[model samples]
Target chain A: MTIGLNAFLIIAGLLFAIGMLGVTLRRNTLVMFMSLEMMLTAVNLALVAFSRYNGTMDGNLFVFFIITVAAAEVAVGLAIIVALFKRRQSVMVEHLNVLSR
Target chain B: MADLLFYLFAGITLISALVMVLMPNAVNGAMCMIVSFLGTAALFVLLEAYFLAILQVLVYAGAVMVLFLFIIMLLDVGEDSPAVKPAKLSIFAALTGFVILSGLVISLFTDPASLPATPAFEVAENPTGLSANNGIPFTTSAKSFGYSLFTKYMLPFQMTGFLLLAAMVGVIVVSKRITETEPEAETTD
Candidate 1:
């Protein structure tokens, strides 16, 4: 029962959808950030699967870059969240209404 | 056996990811995310990407998640408010996700033979010139990965280093506390 490329892809898609749902429904900024990381991981999975199937190092290399970028993103994003929390005393997205005005 | 492992890892990855999202407590969600990353690393191992599998665990599960946990603990974020209902925005997001997923599935199955065959490379070390079982030379090995990273992908690698440096500086700048004397001086002025 070898797993086909399509199966891996479909799994990635489902994981991505779940992450999207979390991002949309969750109001807590930290939870939303975690969901975004889930989405990034899903993409990395797909990239690795394709690399394995295609027998190329390109995809694997790209995955390395993606992971690096993701780490940087998490750093900056969490810092912003911390700053926002300090200002408002909360991490809820609703309290971040200053941008709208 | 490989198929079973794939399913097991996939199940772990998906279930833990869902748990991360659904858990109201940020700390629990971060813990679930760690499990999810571990499962992903296992899947990477199954994919024959051994280097990436280790890196995933080290960077994501070990470092990034620790950072997330530290922030969550430091901020002391509580459970989400129960008052905020799932609004129409959630429905819209769900619909969009469904549509994108269907499109991806359709395109994936549309052309079965569209995927390129795995390219085979001759092994210099093998005396009989027999290709590996996967028909590709040992490209996934750490040596080849490093060689390619330094030679073929050098520029991007350097750029990634710069990006990390910039991100570190940005984090410090953003998270720095405002001094009381500065605010007092501004108020007096």
Candidate 2:
């Protein structure tokens, strides 16, 4: 039962769906951020798998840059979360109606 | 061997990813995400890109996820009850997922350009997967990736250093106080 790239891709697809569900259904800002990270991780898995299958390091290099971006994304995102939570005692997206007005 | 490991890690990754998404408690969800991250790193190892596999473990599972956990702990939010998804809505999501998975599986089977795994001589000669093409003496070791990173890819490599530096500055600016404005009343008004 040798592992196939298809099999790994299927797993990644499922993870992406879960992440999408979390993003769409959850109202909590922190939870949404976690879901976004989930999607990014799934993408990284796909990239590495592609790199292996193609016998090239290009995808791997891109994944490295992506990791850098993800780290930066989370840091700034969390800072925004903290600032928003300070403005309003809640981190719920629904309560951010201040922006809608 | 590959099939078994694939299934095992796939199971762990999927299950933990599900927990990460469905757990109402953000802290619990983040922990589950860490489990999922580790499982992904294990999958990378099985793919035989040893350098990438190690970096995945060190950077993602080690540094980044720990920071996420730290934020969760600092936030100190109580567990909120799971938000109920409407039955019809959940079914719609399930259907969408099924469609996407089936599409990927079909494409995987039909694509003619896919490489055959377990190529004997080719695999042995280019064990590190990159250096041989560029006339570097890889000698079937992990250092090949390092050589490529420092040599052929040095520009982007240095750019990554700059990117990290900018990220550090951005984090500091975003988190720090901009001005000592007079203390305003904490009002819900």
Top candidate on lDDT is: 1
TM-score of chain B of each: 0.75, 0.71
Give every collision pair in model 2. Answer: none
Model 2: how far residue B79 lies from native, Å: 1.9
Residue A31, model 2, lDDT: 82
lDDT of 2 by residue, B9-122 (tens): 989988998887778787888788888988988887776656667777888778777777777667665365346333577657756764676576557644646534433122
- What lDDT would each prediction earn against the true structure? 0.81, 0.72
In model 2, state the lDDT of residue B41. Answer: 84
Q: Assess the local accuracy of residue A12 in candidate 1 as a C-alpha lDDT between 0 and 100.
A: 83
**DockQ score of the complex predicted as candidate 2:** 0.42
Q: Which has the greatest TM-score?
A: 1
Cα lDDT of model 1 overall?
0.81
lDDT of 2 by residue, A1-101 (tens): 35666666767777777788777667677888888988898898888777666556666767777887888788888878887777777777667787688
How many angstroms is residue A100 displaced in model 1 relative to the true structure, after the best TM-score fit? Answer: 3.2
Q: Where is model 1 more than 4 Å wrong at Cα?
A: B88-138, B180-189
DockQ list for all candidates: 0.56, 0.42
